[model samples]
Target: MGSVLAFFVLATVFFYNAGNWLVVSHLPQRADAIVVLMGGVPERIPEAVDLYKSGFAPRLIFPDDYEENPPEVLPDGSLLHNDAAKAMHLSSHFNIPDSVIVIVKGPALNTQVEAEIMAIYLADHPETDTIILVSSSYHMRRALIIFRNEFASKGLEITIISVPSRYTAFDPEKWWQTAGDRKTVFLEYIKIAYNLLWDRWF
Candidate 1:
């Protein structure tokens, strides 16, 4: 009985904290650029576009690995990668001009690689001192940590703004009720732990 009670108590604490950690909303009033990290659902792009339209940033950057893959043929015969397709959709849907959208093409397979690519871009664009990073709510914490660690030596400011994902089954109010949410939250915790250790030791 005591073991069961202890388990329940520990789980309660974990669930509460997990929901809180999933959504880290530290948005700055203004930034030099708005960076939308690719990987999650299509919700991220729209959110970034909204931020851009709201005048949060003058430039929007998307770092994706689509350049390394074959171009996806569209119905209109125009060839575009998944990343470019999304960017184009945002451009047309939001009436954003093509010149304002900057696509940093590279082999960025994960968050770490994306951060590296972004670091290189920041190096080139010395005027961009502050950047707003937009990603899924559940991914914001890990993304922020990785970006902070990656840019620690670069003197760049990163502010995270999380957008709720339509595809991910992360329900902050009742995260433990569904199996998908449980699994995602569990995996996120593991990744967070791994990243923390890796950043510390290596």
Candidate 2:
């Protein structure tokens, strides 16, 4: 009983730390650029596009490791490109213009892996500073930890913000409804613990 209760307490803490607290309190209001971490719910597109349309950042960087093929095919059997990629592609349809979004395909891994690539890209560019590190609110704490540890060592002054993953808000009670959701929260909790332990020792 004690172990079970302890588990619940710990789970709640992780959700609270990584959830809306990061988005509402920690997100940077302005930045030199916006780096939207790919792989969130499809709802984030409008938020990213809106940021661009509103001139929050003249450019948007989406770090991906997209293959040559899209994730699926259209209803008529024609190839539908990667939804995230195509959404950015369709931005011109919304009048945001083709010049605003830059898709950077890094490698297959977690956001830390992708952010490392973004950090390197910023390093090479030299002209760019500040970036909104966009991802689902649940992932923001881990993302920012990885970005700050990795990017700062490279001598780049970047600002990260949690642009809430589209159509989703932070709620711990909602996690237990699905097995996938529960597993994700569990894995994230482990990752958070690993990060905390590693930060203290190394």
Candidate 3:
């Protein structure tokens, strides 16, 4: 009975802290650039903007996925291309100037793709040695790992500092209490597992 009770307690603790375990945050520092991972724009973009405005980095790099957001003809007869990339537009609205906004164009379907494309972009712009990586709080761990691996594979020795978005709706302590939080945590775990499998054996 004692063994079973102990197992239950351990399992409960792990489950409760799952959301927190998935987050990887680091203190912001002066870096060459800030790269905000795609998706989680509502939260991630603002966080990246804060970092940029705070002078953590001289510029912000946004991955552009034309496939994910193709050009659409608006009712005004002007071509609207993803509202200048939603993240970029919001950053501008937040007062991040156009001079410091760099767009890395690619088919960024996932976090891995984003990292790969950014690595490619960095290869051309060799000045950007250090980077501040931003993403959703729950998505930071996987994003950081994927980015590190991507840069390593490309033989780039970039210093990456991961910063989880402060604007996330996820509450690590009570993630399971809300439907949205539960779904976010569940999907994040699945993605992490898949990333592990893909990176390790495949």
Worst 10 residues of 1 by lDDT: 160-169
For all predicted structures, in order, the TM-scores are 0.83, 0.74, 0.90
Question: CA shift at 83, candidate 2, in angstroms?
Answer: 6.1
- Better-scoring candidate (TM-score), 2 or 3: 3
Return whichever of 1 and 3 wins on TM-score: 3
Candidate 3 lDDT (Cα, 0 to 1): 0.86
lDDT, ranked from best to worst? 3, 1, 2
Give Cα distance to truth, residue 195, candidate 3, Å.
0.4
Q: Give the count of colliding residue pairs in each prediction.
A: 0, 0, 0
Q: Which candidate wins on lDDT?
A: 3
Q: What's the true lDDT of residue 141 in model 3? A: 91
Misplaced by over 4 Å in model 1 are 1-11, 67-71, 154-169
lDDT tens per residue, model 1, 65-153: 65525676768887766664566665667787878888887768788888888988887887887788887878888888888888775
Clashing pairs in 2: none
List model 3 lDDT by residue over 1-202, tens digit each: 9999999999999998998998898989999999888777889999998888788988888887654345655566645465237777678779889899888887687788888899999999898899999988999999988999889989999999989999998898889999999998999889988998999987
lDDT of 2 by residue, 1-202 (tens): 9999999999988765543333432544667777777665355666677677777777877776555453566566755345446556556556766676777756636666786788778888877777766666567677777788878777788666656555544464567666776676777768878876876788
Local distance difference test values of all predictions, in order: 0.75, 0.67, 0.86
